[model samples]
Target: GTKTISYGCVGGDFNEVLHAWEKEGGVPRSQRCLDNFKEAFEYCELGDLGFAGDAFMWRNNSHTAEKYIKERLDHVVATQGWCARFPAYRVVNGDPRHSDHRPIIIDTAGAAAVRRN
Candidate 1:
């Protein structure tokens, strides 16, 4: 059987937040889903493409001041080999359409590497 490399993105609220809280020792509580993602990421040697400016990608449609709030649920992940080839990937944020989740665009083709002496 031909070995086909597999890579994907998966996770919800990821309630815990970012990988690095700050410069100090601050580690957020890990959820089961996040844990699974981490494991898969390591298995495939995947790297994060990073979210745009806004931290939260999803939020409650309610107009209330503090309804369900928002969180970083959306993300991009790819195999290490893939990242090496295309290291200039980015996620773009656009106005939310019919849903609470805003649109995200992932640019796979990065800038060409420049050779210097």
Candidate 2:
């Protein structure tokens, strides 16, 4: 019999979106870019931890509306085995304040107690 790895998680600024809806106010992301991200994610057996708060976690901060853009480039993902250990886990998108990208917070205890904008 062989044992399998049961715990894994990946979190960071992936700089890629898995779907068209993950972005706004910019030219549509190429299909290849979306497909590539999806493929790599699935191949790694990662499950999106999901998020609570504003949908977009990053902004271009352009003064002009037309040039402004927003996207969910940051992410938190974990393997099914890892998720089982913290079923109450929650991912929160925190206020950027000064940066263009929002901070990502993962709370394994349950709903995160953080403010979002």
Candidate 3:
């Protein structure tokens, strides 16, 4: 039987808001949302399906540094069972085409993502 791989945009941020970003740019969201995502992730036994591309997946494209916002809000996650099935599986973050969120591509062509972004 083929293993299952779950992935999506997941519009909300995980854990606490990013303070490492620009000033006044990284507004923190409610901890409740973060906790919820964590609970689900653990319950499902999901792991970050590593990517090869820009560090941050979402950008506001703002000109002002203080107002600019960038974050790794999007991701592809997989379970241990799923990973065992596709040992060569990988994920690549695509350029954000006029959108705040970037596109995620699943690569199963056997070309492993060798570098950490």
Candidate 4:
């Protein structure tokens, strides 16, 4: 029998934004940095799990509007093999509470089950 390779999901605060739209009220991410991230993701065969709810996952917590900053620094990526196992997998950005960064929630039971009222 042929061997099967199992690649699991990767999730956390990378501290790097993959695109310009991911960041706001900042100096703006350099194109080189964005390309580097994209290259790495392609090389690793990883795909973003995406998210619902808030678009930004991190905030500078600044009081002034101009001094404030927000970005979707946290993310979840999975290989094709892992995604195939859970077709209905969902990723959500939870409330930050006391922290500047929001919590990442993942539900393999499908969005319907996780979004129950």
Q: Highest lDDT: give the candidate number.
A: 4
lDDT of 4: 0.88
Please tell me which predicted candidate would have the highest TM-score against the true structure.
4
Between candidates 2 and 4, the one scoring higher on lDDT is: 4
What's the C-alpha lDDT at position 113 in model 1? 26
Question: Candidate 1: misplaced stretches above 4 Å?
Answer: 1-33, 109-117
Per residue, candidate 1 scores C-alpha lDDT tens digits across 1-117 of 454675454333343434433112223346665667667666666666675666566776656654545665666666766666656655555567798776676665433322221
How much is the lDDT of residue 81 in candidate 4? Answer: 88
Residue 4 in candidate 1 has what lDDT? 61
Please provide, for model 4 over 1-117, each residue's C-alpha lDDT reduced to its tens digit, 9 standing for 90 to 100.
443447789999999999899999969999999999988887788899899889899999689998899999999998898998888799989987899889999888766675774
Give a tens-digit lDDT track for model 2, residues 1-117. Answer: 453657787888999887899999879999999998988777778878899988798889699999999999998988898898877788889888889888888888764333331
> What would the per-residue lDDT of candidate 3 be over residues 1-117, giving only the tens digit for each residue?
443545432223342332243113557555676667667776666766667888577677699887887777766777777777677776778887777777778876446545432
Give me the runs in candidate 2 sitting further than 4 Å from their true place: 1-5, 111-117
- TM-score: model 1 vs. ground truth: 0.60
Overall lDDT per candidate, in order of appearance: 0.56, 0.84, 0.63, 0.88
Error of 1 at 114 (Å): 14
Q: Let me know the TM-score candidate 3 reaches against the reference structure.
A: 0.66
User: Which residue pairs come into collision in candidate 2?
Assistant: none
- TM-score comparison, 1 vs 3, better candidate: 3
